[model samples]
Target: MTNHIIVTIGRQFGSGGHEIGNKLAERLDIPLYDRNLVNMAAEQMKISPDAAEEVDETGLSRFLAYYASAPVDYSSYYMTNIEMGQPLSEQLYQVQSEIIKRLAGRSSCVIVGRCADSLLADEPNLINVFITASKEDRVKRIVEKYGLTERKAAERIKKIDRERRYYYELHTGKDWGSIESHDMLLNVSAMGIDGAVDALEALYKAKK
Candidate 1:
């Protein structure tokens, strides 16, 4: 059967979620949307890629994104306090939501983060997965990947996870990383990244 299943993954900071998503996409021969969603949203917003990155996913309140997309010159170039009702982070989220919907409409693919699970919640072919790991394991992964001390890795994980949680909650009105919000929650600390991928592959096929 030709399956068109959309898999959306939410991961902890150092849980190897992106790696799992990338591997899953490769295994299934489907496109993976992770960091590339920022670029795609930038293009959609008619702004430079870096502009989108400025307000990409941190949920920061800034006007750089507004200035980048708005047709305003120096007259209001420094109007960083302009009230556009929605923050730059929210605007980026809206744009990426459109992209996610369009991508899901086109074919089966794997989307990492950006609250894609909630955005595509109505689709029958949608499978939402949240991957997590123990703090110890995650800290080790972060330290190894970034050459950071264990203390630094733990700190970084806390910061990014908090931002992601707030971002997800702000947009979706759902508790981030909760099992009830997703279709499947994978604890890959012991199973490993590839093992998690194997389980997800089976899930996609079984869901079909």
Candidate 2:
């Protein structure tokens, strides 16, 4: 409804997906919605942004052990014996979808992750992209960027990828990272972020 070119980026873990999304927004002079969405959702839900961010991107419930494992008490501390009943990840997904829809309607912005590609599937002017890289490249990048040990970096990357894929599959019932879901699928390890953005801009202009 806003008539702005919406870009949704899906990426492999540690592939610089968020950075590329940010850079693209800066170049286009458009708003970028990424972790800010998590923050907003967190504020709305009265939860920590850290908590929201953990469950923000990727396949649903697959990383429950790693990301969404909220602390609970089963001991005498539970005098009420009533679970606070935290919002399910699916419910959070719905909230995020609504937030994205509202944001897109008001402005042309780049949204990264959080099932945005599928959520905006009906929009005529949306460009969905999937970014990926070789596991080796991702591992190296993670190590250097996060100053993590090789083993830790590899574990982190793999865990994040799994969670993302699980989330996508759970929410959309479509395989994550499938080429069909995206209008453009680029390997940043091959072209770099700027090159990818350039190619995307060209594609959008041509489509327009």
Candidate 3:
């Protein structure tokens, strides 16, 4: 059995997934990959970070459709043009997937979002987790974190969740947030961030 483990976390918008991931990584003494993933991919692809973020999870379908019909050699010439090649979203996914794999190979780490669960699904020591909270709790969290009103936070939550669902399903051909899609599903609202981290740590120890 492999000694290294990778923890992939998929989360609802206001579920404190980021915080949980940070704590888990800190406790485990491993790196945490989150938004920095975009920066890394941007650097690898030689594109601006802003450009990568714009298309991150929102452009997967268009990229897939374009690539499916485009010629295999299309990237050879198009890649030269910053905005003319494969969709930025697709490029970001490809670059980040490679980075995620490389990171897992080097050491155990906690990765939040960017479809890391699906990207590393085949790894023997991978633990795929989905973090969520009740709608009420999520809304309250979003309001406090983003300084948004209750109505605005609720809207933002729906929008982000929809984008995430589309991106994950598009890439993995699996239902996002479904019990079967993850090895473990956690409710941050009920478990709290520390509780969730402890639960994951226990699971990891048992797996080891």
lDDT of 3 by residue, 1-208 (tens): 2468889999988899999999999988889998888789879988766567666765323333443464222232223335656665677788888998888888888999988888787789888999999999999997887677799778778877899899999988999998999988999888899999999898778877
Q: Whose lDDT is higher: candidate 1's or candidate 2's?
A: 1
Encode model 2's per-residue lDDT on 117-178: one tens digit a residue: 88888888999999998889999998887677789778888877888888888888877898
In lDDT terms, how accurate is model 1?
A: 0.81
Which portions of model 3 miss their true places by more than 4 Å?
A: 58-85
Q: Give the RMSD in angstroms, all C-alphas superposed, for model 1.
A: 5.9
What TM-score fits each model? 0.85, 0.83, 0.85
Alpha-carbon lDDT, every model:
0.81, 0.76, 0.81
Candidate 1: the clashing residue pairs are: none
User: C-alpha displacement of 142 in model 3, angstroms?
Assistant: 0.9
Angstrom error of the Cα, residue 30, model 1: value is 0.5
Position 112, candidate 3: lDDT: 94
Clashes of each: 0, 8, 0
Can you give the lDDT of residue 88 in candidate 2?
45
How much is 163 displaced in model 2, in angstroms? 0.3
